[model samples]
Target: MTEESENTGGLARRTLLRLGAAGGAAAAVAAAQTWAWPLLAQRGLVSPDGAFAAASTVFSDALYIEAFPTSPLILSPFNDPLPVLKALAPVPKTVFSKWPQPPGPGPGQQNSLRNERHQVWTSQVGLPDPIVYKINLLVRTHSFTTSQVLPIDKDGRPAVSFDAKRKTYAAGTKRFLPPSTIYGFNGGFPGARINAEYGRPVLVRFENHLNENPLNLDRQDFGSPDLSFLTHLHNSHTAPESDGNPHYSMVAGPRHRGYRPGMFVDNLYLNRPAGNDDGQKQSFFWFHDHTMDHTGANVYKGMVGLYPIYDPKNGMDMGDETRGLRLPGVRTNNPDGSFDVAYDIPLAFTDFRFDDGVTIHKDFHDGQGEFPAAKNPATHPEWWGKTFYKHFPNHGFVGDICTINGTAFPVLEVKRRKYRFRFLDASVARIYEFKLMTSTRGPKSSASLGYNGEELQGQYRIEDGQQCMQFNEIAVDGGLLPVPIKRDSFELWPAKRREVIVDFTRYQDGTPTTKGDVIYLTNVMKMPNGRKWAASTRFSPDPNYKIPLLKIVIGDTVPDNSLVPTALRARPPLPSNWQSLLDNRLIFEVQRGSAGGELEWLINGKPFDPFHALPSLKNPAGRTPLAQQKKGSFNLWELRNGGGGWVHPVHLHQEEHQVVMRNGKDVTRTPDPGHPDDISGEDTAALDPGESVILYRGFRDFTGPYVGHCHNLSHEDHAMMFAWEITP
Candidate 1:
């Protein structure tokens, strides 16, 4: 949107709301377009069930996923092997030099130096052998990769490839040329994927070229803490050390300033050939720097990647059976026509645009913070994270522009045979709904969005009032958590990824000219955080800026016969945990906010104290990592929701849960969090304004420090999150 156009809209919306404010009357307000209307209705800002224009097109398709090396949220098979922990590094450094000279000038007045402190790791997966995979985590020194590799050693890091004349990284490398957005990550975020498979052991080595920042720079200001990274094979994440826990991060490199492990890192992460059940087949999972305050910059600078672990034992590798269906394959192949690439392909999808001249000021004395990029007072207004962002020619934040395989709408050369597309939503906060555009006459870049659950083969129904109840909406910050931003350009919801398969054989033509299987995978992600980006806050919902996130233009291509979804399933069945809720004996109310000397959170309306444990009957994990303290061995524990600002996803890390009492009622229709494999599904009742709901969660496995917060990443980041111990 242009400046003038935005200004006009802003004035109009604000004026409408302000003028409508009259005494003893409902305000004729104009809420943020993207905010949820249902929430507005509850707040009395708008009438209930108001007509809302379709924000963006919807989708319906069964997505098949393949797990691999890295991850979005690592998903693994149950039989997966234990993880193998190895220390590899090309680790970056946080270099510092004491000002005044030392006693004898022993080392030329050098006071201190430390390797960059971002958590980086490389893991390999092979169906048979442990192969040597060279993984490159070349973080832009002081991270200015979006502008390409700026040669200047700005902020004390190496600027080998950047140009002094242009003040930006070289125009373009192989993947990045022109008309493409530049973000962080060495060879693009999520790096490149080679060969991987389920139930196999492999090794990935890091070429640590990260040097010490001579000019002194804070580590956390740019990317995640360099010293904080864990190679979670996602589903197969084993060892405690490799778990990438916020509290258990470690550093790697020639430098040994890494965090210590109180116990053997014994999750799947520490095993050699990692294997763990991913629970579900068609979803996205991954790995990242879980360090506090470092998540934003680190992921922004490309320290994130995908982990698509496929269950080979499952019928997942039957792509050839579905002749027309394309299968995404990242399998370790034997090459030749006899190799595993038969009908498999890999698509590591991620794109990031950078703020030009990005810079950070820090006192290498200790990894603290950084200086925000400079701003043009006349052009750019002061923003939150902006006060610390330092860089020139900022490209600004883009949840819109997409680069599949490091290029916008990149074309893949596939054989006449079937192929698979392993998709991962690596964006910070965007829910994507993508479709493989194909038509009989030709290819179209759009899909038919008729979310009428009626068009299904089986009569699988959750039948509300009988089996489950629907969730109500809650609004905060003058809006809802999922700030609805759906349009012709993009749809990006926080942390939503989809995996789809495309078959070239079905299309008959590749593009307009070639009559072959040439497919265009188009994505329409919900971009709510756009407002957050503009306001320098990714959590709070605001109606200030609207932007398109991503668009796919095939130019010209032939369509395909049809696209097949993994399963025509809607919601899963509700678990039976609710039956035991009557036995609850312990209950607590959790709240969050920045307090005390550092940031703080609370439980039962009280700030969280590390030395304290909310009263509970038994340690759910029996002392294992999944050993969370159970409210009652029978039925004494309860966490009732007191409708407030935001609705936390309230995930119990070790076990799944189900809704039992929503605002004081036994709603059979609520989803069964522990219900396993019964099509009679349900939706978990959501917390309504001033409402109380009851949920039941049974003990599962390993007990360790787990976080229960809003699935909404933004809220979780801004202190609306907390942690608990499941100890006896």
Candidate 2:
């Protein structure tokens, strides 16, 4: 298609009007003739009719339907039943082919593992519901090379590096990523959950065998087809190459003559605590594609998976009920004789938009594409998927469907026992304020309290809205808190994870709850435009996202083997020299700008650049550094929000930092017995406009490149990130 034609393409308003008229005349005919789901999937386009259905289905699919879990909860820490030890080059060609369609569903729809490469480790859990049903696992192993290696001086002194010719690679065409298709780790979606031990040394070799040419890159006029990757382990103590800094993204394929293609990158995870201090160790971390200019879209396409670390000897080990902390763990086989991560469940919450034909949605926009800044064109001839406005892309995308562990509005049969839920919001741009409530069969009531005395957070017109459940939050992004905090509800921004323990057998007051009671996992934060949430007490929830997420039907009682501890782990005291470092704190101003009819999310007035060296004393050369710190050193950093009525969840990689103060005032520390330590540290913090936070971060145990960015991936993808180095 010509550039002019592509620019003019999309489901225009006039076409929507025609579809409306056709729908009124004959609903069945409109559905049949316009819903070309298969063709739409193949071509990556959504017709006006499909767009309309996709928009309205959110409320319809979630509000009225009552569903139950037909499959067991997915357990992580579960090994790939079929682990492929050998690696292959050029990634299997079939890796980019249309994923096989599962039986009785949308054509070319991929929900579970069906191919041989993927079948080794993944399997599907079938459900009878026709609305939308499928569970697919993503897995793969590829081999490729790259020359984007970090440079060091001849004397082997890091940071004060050498190789002037190596610097020229940045100016070379080959400096950028090669043409390749994107896929989840091990080549599958929700990639495999990697279970590693804290303080352990492990080597991970990532080979990029992405298809040399993927369909999304076919149109040179739109979207990023960069076939390189920068895999960040969120907040792990790893060398620079493994930190997955956007500035250090690596590409595959043969390099120009004499230059070897930088395809594979080996990351060494020290697995040590952020500062070598036992109290600062992180338990739950994840790995995902962090390629610059494409983190958001790449992750949206499913380049994310779990990487949970543990201190086998001193950790909350769920490996066996007889060892370690003994909390409900993986390896605890279910009645079906299949094993899963038991009470220690990882719920990866994400949202998606589908075309009216029910295929996944994709919006193509290269900085130079027509309507590059606009989500939809006011007047266009071809369907460009669904949009709320004309010609501009949405500030943030929010799908009508909220999926957990890859299932849409499904049911979970929980035993009348305590379960530890690890909630990770992996959405590209959706925030969820979750609440646990019970259902009522008759007309919805206006009650704001549970049958007993549980304090309800918001009004749920879907049923008798009683906030019957409460969560004992044990940890934040960094790991387990010094102590737990019990709250009626908690807000989860994208890319944030919270560990909470919920006891299904009792109410908040320790009263034995009914054995057959049914409850729901609901969202109440009403985010109409995917913007900042309203200011309100944690208990007084936002009513906007009040949709049901999971249905919990109290099942038969099982032998309870887990217990929420009185204390998990305590954080160690700061280094004695911490006070001195505080005087020279690093300050990052989260700023935004508008230019050429587009909004820019930035840090310190600059978009992310890997080579933009920082002016610092340690490395006088300032080799493209945003911030610099000596290895094994401690420093204070301040996150300042540039007011614009927006909330930024700042996430720091490579280490977890403790939030010491907010808005110039010391944060009141909360002590809970459920944790082994006090809650004072975090990897991601939500900063409201006009707000600021001071964090104490440690750059210890490793030296290399790392990143700190807004976890609201939409913001990060648009340049709200920076690269920093740890010097030796």
Candidate 3:
């Protein structure tokens, strides 16, 4: 069969299975595979989808559902300006003295000024008055969409609804589904934004309230089985005690896995740049759960929060467009005491799968005989239409539904003016290549377009000829770029952040956008099962595929003041003798290990051993410790992707690095054509298959154990992580 025919046949089979004819479709596919496999192999046209046809068939038959029943109509309207969380007042000294259950330490004993480990640094740095806030981790319910859908009970019956007005499910006739259970920060999904600034340190007393379950929902099998918690501020240059890494938690703080319920920990974020350098100021960060062996599960369960730090030094002020680079924003102090910056939005992209009311939610842990089979069953049927998760997905988990800012397929109304968007990919393994496109024809159901299963993730698509809008990318995971890059599209890997300035007033072709014009933040990257991208616009474009994740409606014109500057923050210059350190540089390779469950992911052929250091490539005999670095020193570290047809986004904690070499090519002198943004300082390295990157990194300010791991949470949770330390 021709490639076109094969493709058409596969789509038809998938559609049939999606329509509930799975038995017949599977039989036909099984019968044909014996003869068709050879032909497809001979033609070198064996697709990733075809290779995993059985799993795809099972998913389409029972686990698949359209993202939403209705098209754009059901999409939640985006909350204008987003929501800002109010900071809680500091607890009184008398009340703070009895934090632990048995009251271990008094106020003076635990205070940052009095604590021996932090007293010297606090005094030496002349730390200003800290902004003390309290945050809690609790089990709560979250709604992904505003629309109501069918929900099933434990006995496979339509769930009974409890009306708040009537106060009784028996009196209520309307059937309403229960909200998905989530372990959230302060009882909020995506938590609430912490609008922070440089020069002001933040001292957060994080309390664990996960033991409380007022909603009485059956907690799923995912997340830490013990309900312990550890919060990490991603890529922050903080001391080990506040880093929230498992290395420090396991060795120093708790001397166990994580902080237990009813316990609280004081995390002091100095909010200072690395090496006290003005050039190293970072802007965007996120705090989330980082418990060992459960980071992915905890994060997926909604234990995540956003932090956007601003620089108020040297005219680079926050939201005061008149003085600084004027990146689109207007500061507004709310009556509730929370601050908000209009037009400066944080869009966190996450993916999820809802139970189809049939297929059981199962993972490697369920069948591994670790838990009692009958008493602690991993499968749940009463969670119909609620979020479903698999703890140990072989190829890593990629959800079938896409959400931004905790809402699926949301719509945002934008004024015909410039706006600054901080984009974050919070998904487990999915990588997104996003573009702003205007479609002549609006959203249509994916079923009408012959797409099924994961293809129906967005539920709606715009198949008409869509024109792309350009963006001025001004920042990456680290911070502001040295110069802005104009691009029609850019890829965002898991845990990676990209900031862009978009002018809704006009298109790239100089056409003025008018009121009522609709634009879509579309995703064009096609990732079938998270092993890797099936298609990407940067390399191989899929013309027929584009999922509209967010709808942007053009509104009334507004006065413009923000400027996309030609030059932004400058990166620290490398030492003239940087190349001399290459010979002694530590090298680590991330790759697949023995196939099966969590053991598949590995770095340097070993699982995560926080207590021991892994030897560098040059010291294979284990004579030298590569994971230990001296404070106040700089070094070159090479990260290699041991080929397995997979992409790994490697993230290093504490300090951002400057990429000097890519695959032995000098990227410092010349920017990489495929990744021009590599010239910018970044904490995460996006490594394609078989790619190698040499990074110039620094170890400074504070000391103790930290970690470097794959930003793909699943990979990190499994084994693709290593512990490193900075010695005094």
Residue pairs in collision within model 3 = none
For the record, the alpha-carbon RMSD of candidate 3 to the native fold, in angstroms, is: 9.9
For each candidate, C-alpha RMSD in Å? 17.3, 19.6, 9.9
Model 2, 498-528: lDDT tens digits are 8888999987767777766777787777553
Clashes of each: 158, 55, 0
Q: Model 1 has how many clashing residue pairs?
A: 158
Candidates in descending TM-score order: 3, 2, 1
Best by lDDT: 3
TM-score of 3: 0.83
Question: Candidate 1 lDDT, tens digit per residue, 1-728?
Answer: 11232132223221221222221012212221335456555656343213121111000000001110100100111112111111122112121123121111122211122222211122333234333333444433321112222111112222222222333334222111122111222444455433334454334333333333333322323443333333333333332233444422322221121222211121122122211323222222445434443344445555555444433445443233333222333333333211233333334444443222222222211212122331122112111111122111111122323444343333344444333434444444334434344323322111111111111100011111010111111111111111111112222233333233433443323332234433334432223222222221222422212211122222233333223433322323344554544543354443432111012223444332222333432323332122246432223234544333333333333333344555556645542232211122111222322445455444323334444433233333333333554443
Full candidate order by lDDT, most accurate first: 3, 2, 1
Cα lDDT listed for each candidate: 0.30, 0.52, 0.73
The weakest ten consecutive residues by lDDT in model 2 span 251-260
Best TM-score among the predictions, by candidate number: 3
Worst 10 residues of 1 by lDDT: 55-64
